[model samples]
Target: MISAPPPRPRDTTFGRSTPDAMQLSPDIPTVELTSLLGGGREAVILHNGERYRLRVTANDKLILTK
Candidate 1:
């Protein structure tokens, strides 16, 4: 029987962060997801008086919706 090929590993680097090339700007504040979500899968963000829902999908990707 024919079988499917093995799945390739997901690239979490987002095509930017690399060893020796990784540099974060001090101007922008960094916040960890753990601290932001407080160990939850979702968090609500308030921006410009609008409410947005930010949640992690089943595939472990993030999604934001109004």
Candidate 2:
């Protein structure tokens, strides 16, 4: 039998990510945004118990709270 790698954490920080998604590297920290138009790409919101910010870019990018 073979054992799989450890499971990754959820997107509690911000910007919801589905299962089997690429997780953010520990070295690179995402920068969260505040507001946006229509709330599509380039939009951010508070998360993680209101301790972080999540941003989405036009290119489907994500960042943590600044």
Index of the highest-lDDT prediction: 1
Model 1, range 37-60, lDDT digits (tens) per residue? 899999999999999999988987
* lDDT values for all models: 0.82, 0.56
TM-score of 2: 0.25
Q: Report the lDDT tens digits of candidate 2 across residue range 1-66.
A: 999989998657454466335566779755433334354544344565565545565676766665
Q: Pick the candidate with the highest TM-score.
A: 1
With candidate 1 superimposed using the best TM-score fit, by how many Å does residue 48's alpha carbon deviate from the native?
1.1
Q: Report backbone clashes per prediction.
A: 0, 7
TM-score of each: 0.62, 0.25
